[model samples]
Target: MSQIFDFSGNEEFYHGGSIYSNPKEAGSFLSLGIVNHVDVYFPNKRARISAPLVPGGESLEQKKQVSLDVLPDECLYEILRRLPGDQERSSCASVSKRWLMLLSSIPSADLCNKFEVVAEEGDEIESDGFLTRSLEGKKATDVRLAAIAVGSGGRGGLGKLTIRGSNSVRGVTDLGLKAVARCCPSLKSVSLWNVSSVGDEGLVEIANGCHRLEKLDLCNCPSITNKALFAIAKNCPTLTSLSIEGCQYIGNEGVQAIGQFCPNLKSVTIKDCPLVGDQGVASLMSSASFVLTKLKLQGLNVTDLSLAVIGHYGKTVTDLVLANLQNVNEKGFWVMGNAQGLQHLRSFTISSCRGVTDVAVEAVGKGCPNLKQFVLKKCAFMSDNGLMSFAKAARSLESLQIEECHRITQIGFFGLLLNCGPKLKALTMSSCFGFKDMILGFPLPNKSAPLRSVTVSNCPGLGDMTLAMLAKLCPQLQCVNFHGLPYITDAGLLSLIESCDAGAGLVKVGLSGCVNVTDNVVIALAKYHGGTLEVLNLEGCGKVTDAGLVAIADDCLVLNELDVSKCAITDFGVATLARSKQLSLQILSLSGCSMLSDKCLPFLVKLGQSLMGMNLQNCNSISSSVIDMLVGRLFRCDILS
Candidate 1:
């Protein structure tokens, strides 16, 4: 055949039987012809025919089918690098001996994220063996050991270390942790979850040795006392963030030490630390006045006596959380009420404080004029008068949460909404009897001040009219949560989804307790903004099914966190969510999804690398095998019982 020929001169490609005259088309046509001939000749070895075989140093262009053997080392390395993580890399190694050899030769730093030492159950020498192995294999020295002892005759590592343990490791004493800390010199972040054995001594060792430590999470570590704070303040002068939530032994003294010594501290959280009183918090605020910007003091024993002390020194705080301050009364509020320098404060949460009346609530609005986020839940005494105060004072407020407040009636709520409509971007109103029918008829935000989110849960009075009104006024609303509104049906929810401005911004939604809502509403949401929705809490909702979940998983690319706990979803829905190829999901809660079984757990294992939190509490079908696989895959995840 001629290499080059005009259409008029040659009929080889047109009239001839073969389509191999042109080079580009010839290669593809020849490949197809060869594949067909191979399949016909070697029917039993058709699978083998698909596998490309080539000689060493041969180019990929020489083979009809692309051969893995001909790829350059650098090109193959790049291809392996593009795989998701080590799990995927390991699967690729099984393809052939070349891949397996290449993966084994690669450095641990390039092949692994971090050194992980996992101790088997009832293995006495497990800790020592793992530590010895880790010390022997040194590519880059940052190790994470789970449920393994690292000090006090256990095992020790010289590299940067992270020690995480469960309740099963009762022998993991403070001395054990201290031994590891004394051994390691390059530690940066120490996150201790549910490890009650660690006390002040162990923490002090970490503070002293890890001078460059930036993050310290001690959640549910109850034995951490004031002595730990002294050690931290004295040694880790560069500590920037510290969380001491659920540490029962820590008191005002520890906080005072942090205030006095940690000059560079920027964030501090003391959630559910009952011994940390108002005075201790006040001392911390006064000491770290210039540097502290993020402070969370939830469930502390702070009272009205310390309000003045906090207000004086905490004026510069940007993110402040004081939820469940049971002793916070009118007096304490008045002290903060009169603060003059709290204009910089942005986010504030003061929920579950029964002592705080409308007077105290009003004072905060007056005192912190620049406050943008305000969460006031179970504040029984807050009424229309307090709403008036907020309207008059806090014009910059954007997010407001007023749930379980019985005193706020429809008339007052409407009046307050009218004032906040211009500035409010997110609003949550729940369990209030007064705003029932009135909210349905009330006008909402203007074009200039469009609402982005609204959550109305357990509000029995809210009907179709109220939703229609909200849909009309807040055209830019991205999320609307109506958890317990029985009156709302598919019509109301459909209207809201359809009214989404340009169908781009609406992301999350909740109709959990809306008994009237059916599959129709769920389908509507899945059809509209399912691509962007990340959280869809349909707990106790009997309407949704596998069809709706499949629709959502297929459309939503960014859906990461989902809470379908207690819903009637079956294994079909669970399988769909677990097998999603989007790769963005990180948390899935199927606590009460009874129909889901162990069949879908393998998919969860495949998808578990990115997951950080998962809840499978009451899923009876899941056994120990699934748990083992999940634990192995999700190294840094928090899995609840």
Candidate 2:
């Protein structure tokens, strides 16, 4: 008997070109000793395929069609999870919408572990063993961030994330950060810049989730406050570096919490945070269980009390930078130095601080016995007496840089050179109005100074005599940079270079903006130090011509970087350089050389074999098409046209 079943209530079903609205119709089709099958798919449900028996109690044998769409969601997810690479999974997802949903459901942590396993098998992991991702402007959206939270797991764990300047309408908010926090537990460093949409909630989530975070930088994030910082202090115990800038809401309480909780903190930088005061600075310096090695405080409201605390408690500090502290006076620096706790300080920078006077300078020199590098800028009160005294007292100082110190005269400058220890290897002075070419009765140093680098720039008062004096004092100079000194003629530079020791050849020579410098200086440099010269900058020296370029090409075999912007060099010089078989030039800048045209493009292309970067801005004779052609030919070089 052919048992008939009713299918009238169900929707129309089709099989083998037959529409079977009821069981009787379906029975007729089945009566031919053929098994009829119907495949149905339901949304959010497992797919099912059913077949009915024939009248003779026999079932028709047929081949079943199988595909990813017909598979169960759990099965599909497992298949996607087992895929060895992100590219493979991505290819699968592109097939249909169902695969994409399944792929997104996989746990990112598991994917990260699987990726690590694969990396270990293939030996593809980098030495750092980390992945970095950045989101900026329109890209800083919750959907994209969520994708990163998931996709980054498949390649390698996300170790660093940077979010800069979010979209004004749909910027990254707590939701995006929360997604990151939920998935990327391996995150070690995070930087947020100008992201006003993210607030304390997002940061708190990160702090609670990424306990291994070692560095955090927040700049211009107005919404972040003490709450987020406090949360981080309590949760991120291994935090080693922290920088907060332009966050008005962050004050002493947040810093105090960090000082009290984060015992392993190594570096702290707080800039333009007006609310920070003495208590916060004191706590950060005195409350830390371990010695802080670096501290930078700028544009803060803290006074001398903070400096005193730092001087007393910062026994192991190696680097300290204090700038624009209007409230701090000479008394504070004097007291801090007199305390003598900066015995291990190696590098110290003071800029635009009223406290950097003669008294404070001498105190610092006498106090920091191990100080090796000192940089003073815009210290108007610092005169020759204090500089001379500092030179005499700082026996261990090896590098001194003075900028815009109008009170430092030629007498003090000479005294510094004479009194500073023989270990002083670098001296940089710029924009000092007090450095006048005055006759000095004191005898020059009896022996050649051990100074290897000297840079003097933009000092109208400095002249040929100053360079002559420098040449007499330091005969073993390896790097010389003189800029914007119109008085420095070829005679001065020639004297300096000729005095250099033969064995210690000049490695870098920069005479940019020295209008008085002509091809003679360049020719002298090529003849005397070209074999060892690696970097030569003659930018703005309009008097230089192709002769200098020819000399450099002929002699500077190892020269890798050369800048001759605004010079009088033509195609002849460029062609000469291109034909040089020995020149290993990597970086070339010919900006503002209007004389150069399409004629020089071929020559530059020839030189681009080993060149990594080139700049030809303002070369009007060369059209954009030619520049584009040059760029195409030199695919590996970065061209700034």
Best-performing candidate as measured by TM-score:
2
Q: Write down the lDDT that model 1 would get.
A: 0.67
What is candidate 2's local distance difference test score? 0.84
Q: Residues 1-641, candidate 2, lDDT per residue (tens digit)? A: 23223333244433334345574765554333232133333222222333454345555333355454664564455556667776676577567656654565565444533434335457544213188999999988866676666566556578999999998888998878887776677788999999988999999988987888899999999999999999999999989999999999999999999989998899999999998999999988888725689999999998999888888888989999999999999999998898888889999999999888999999999989999999999998999999999998998989999999999888887788888886799999999988787667778757777789989888888888888888898888999888888888988889988989868799999999999899999999999998899999999999999999999989887899999999999999999999998998999999999888898878999999899999999988889999999988999999998
Q: Residues 270-345, candidate 1: write the lDDT tens digits.
A: 8998888977887888888888889887888888766777677776788887778887778888777687656688
Model 2 Cα shift for residue 321 (angstroms): 1.3
**lDDT (CA) per prediction:** 0.67, 0.84
Q: Which runs in model 1 stand beyond 4 Å of their true positions? A: 1-170, 193-196, 219-223, 246-248, 431-435, 438-449, 490-510, 518-641
